[model samples]
Target: MMFSSKKRQRGTLNREQKKRRLFLFTVILAIAILFGDYHSTIASSVGKETLTMITSPDYPPYEFYETKDGERKIVGFDIDIANYIKKELGFKLKIAQSDFNGLIPALQANRADFVMAGMTPTPQRRENVDFSIIYYEAQDTIVASKSSNLTKPEDLSGKIVGVQLGTIQEQNAKQIAEKVPNIKLKQLNKVPEIVQEIKAGRIDAAIVEDTVALGFVKANPDLQFNVIPSIENASGSAIAFPKGSQLVKPFNDVLQKMKNNGELERLSKKWFSANLTEEPLSTNSPPAASKGLNLDFRRIIPDIPFILKGIPLTLSFTLSSVFLGLFWGTALSFFKISGIKPLGWFANVYTSIFRGTPLLLQLSLVYFATPQLTGYDISAFQAGVFTFTLNSGAYMSETIRGGIQAVDKGQFEAAMSMGVSYPMMMWDIILPQALKNILPALVNETIGLLKDSSLVATIGVVEILRSAQIVGANKYIYFEPLLFAGLIYYVLVMGLSFAASALERKLRRSD
Candidate 1:
């Protein structure tokens, strides 16, 4: 009996030693990966001489996609001005694009040196970022279908008025709503969407800038716009910089010189003189979107290659997020089952925080708030991967934990009986079986990530949806590109489903 007792003690001591070694290995590896990732990011930005300017690029005459000679590039009044300033300031310029609403957050995140999206410096916006002197002023116009007869702000009473979300026109619409009783405002992300709403009769009218309205009116002959007579001289467009940015003074100086020398007027004439902002890749004029879905697939044929380019980026993002999430989730699962109070509590709390919050909110916080909170200047791609990893880890930890627990508990005892170390048994014998049990769940998560990859477009990662939006913005038509994008997503998801099913069959055959 004493001999047996000694043997048991020896086994216990061996197991404890193995646990310690496993823990040490995991901690060291995690540290190494994190350090390497952060270091590489820092290194990439160290010697860069380029300054990034972020903009929405959907509003033509200010900024929009100009497709010519089978190449699409952002060009307009704002693009010219930004280029001029870059030349004068002796800095290479890199233009970045995002949602109109996301422009301020990009600056706040240090993601851009300045913003020139025909943004006006309202008191509310001024509180967040510093602005340059007014560069160009534009009047707001009420845009509606020809039959609506809603030409004035007073004419909008009891009618629905659409405005681009986060624009000065939205604020102006609110002021109009205050005076015009029963007028309701509907907000959309882009001017094209608001104009489409008017054409579709979803909204009676839209408050759009005159220069922007010109493009839509020409594109959709059914629409008409009348300028809203101003109560105050309109606050004109200005360049936005992060608070306390040194570039503001220099940017303003260049703008002052441009104004004095008539450079700004020259650019204005170059873009604003024409209702069509771009040289269309194809001369085909898509039929006006009628009451039914009148899709002109030919309109986006020239842009199909552009949309297809995003596939690689989308795939890479999904795989990277999946791999990172799997690694993190595996660790979190071990922590939860480690049988230590602190670790279990930490794992549970972390999972709860991530899982309970909306993924969109989490993504926005990580992309926009990380730089402010951590000073990391994380790229949209990096921020997307990191946020998705954390969020996916939370969900997957539970999935993994269940998988691990589903493995016959007797197998663990059997391995322990043979004097196999706990870590060795767990890694070599248990995890393989556990993962097999959870194969379907993992595949589902992967498919979900593939679809979710489109979310990166909001922060400017130029994936499939953003590519389609760019095409729409350039063409002044919305549905065809979006429908085509939808088709691409459907095809991708179907392909993934087939691959996963085949993998499942192969694994089942092996078993």
Candidate 2:
């Protein structure tokens, strides 16, 4: 009986042990499954999180690109609002900066998550983008040189009207000009440029947003222009989103919260001196009677081949200019450091003029006006490269000079003591290390030149931005083609940055 009881006890113990092991195994498997699912979902979501946004930093009071300590940072009322909405909606913000006209096309290609450049919710813009609540109110006003006779928008007729390309003010200015006849449109890139152009007498008058015009006049007391009490048009600016966005509700919800919390009012007062937040205009307008989002994207697709043909020319222009800039900049740097008073002074003056003047003006002089002055008819492509190279060289000379100066004086002395000539000492010992130190700056400058290369489009160089504009004009769908152009630029810049970082890392490792 005792043996039978012992066997029963052992059997019970074995059964309990088996049950405990099975439970532990099941728990481990469930945990593994849960972890795998979570990780996979995260990976998948990351892959799907491709959101794009387009903006131009040149529009102040709304958007501005700023550089601090050599790092590019975009800031403005529009940027702040966009960032807030992006955070609220739990989406990534990929910002692409460009001329104002490029914003709409950027949206059409699913490249821009939204455009938050304080763009007015125009009937025309409504045809392409889905707009959120109107964020601010602006009245159109005309600004001219303080000395100009322009008193009204009517006075702008038959005279140069400098307006930013994509603003409702531009359209209003055009409409008003139609009444007077033969008004010339001199579209400029940004507010600052518009003011500068008017100040420089490049344009007779500039039709601009009232707030912007006010700011300009206040800043420049000497450059006076009377505001035309005749308001061309009044409109509310809003955040633009791509059509059928799931993020729209979340964005609007957060925008409302911000408004109620007085955040919007605070920002408004901070930027524009008044609270302008109001319920967004109705976006639910039955998708326009026009085909697919009121934009015919297909019309432009046919030009993709021709546009692609320009890529090689663009690359050639970039590479050639960069090469010439580096070579000429190095020579200029040597001349500056040579201590030869006349040569150094000449180099200094050259650098100063190129640095102070706008690249666009330099390009114009090179391509359009230089022929008259120098009696040489330069091709637009050649002139663009020439101007860019010279401008880049001037900027790079300063960078190179700084890098060389940063190198220890002892290195140069050591090479001199070793019986090396001045040129040999610079090339063999100093330049190698100086170039290494300045390599990152050079790469960054290259990226800048790449972006600025779009300026060449103005001279009819059929580059990416110009190509997109052509496409936009043909299709009347402004956002998609511009979006594609911005994407191309962003990808190119990112790739260049990656390469620079990788090279830097490799160089550091070698050190």
Best lDDT among the predictions, by candidate number = 1
Per-candidate Cα RMSD to the true structure, in Å, reads 17.1, 19.1
Q: Count the backbone clashes (under 3 Å) in each candidate.
A: 0, 12
What is the TM-score of each predicted model, taking all chains together? Answer: 0.85, 0.47
Q: What is the Å distance of residue 126 in model 1 from its true position?
A: 2.4
Worst 10 residues of 1 by lDDT: 279-288
* Candidate 1 C-alpha lDDT tens digits along 245-294: 87777778889999999998888878775544554222234434466656
lDDT of 2: 0.72
- TM-score, candidate number 1: 0.85
Checking candidate 1 for backbone clashes, the offending pairs are: none
What local lDDT score does residue 103 receive in model 2, on the 0 to 100 scale? 72
Q: lDDT of candidate 1 vs native?
A: 0.85
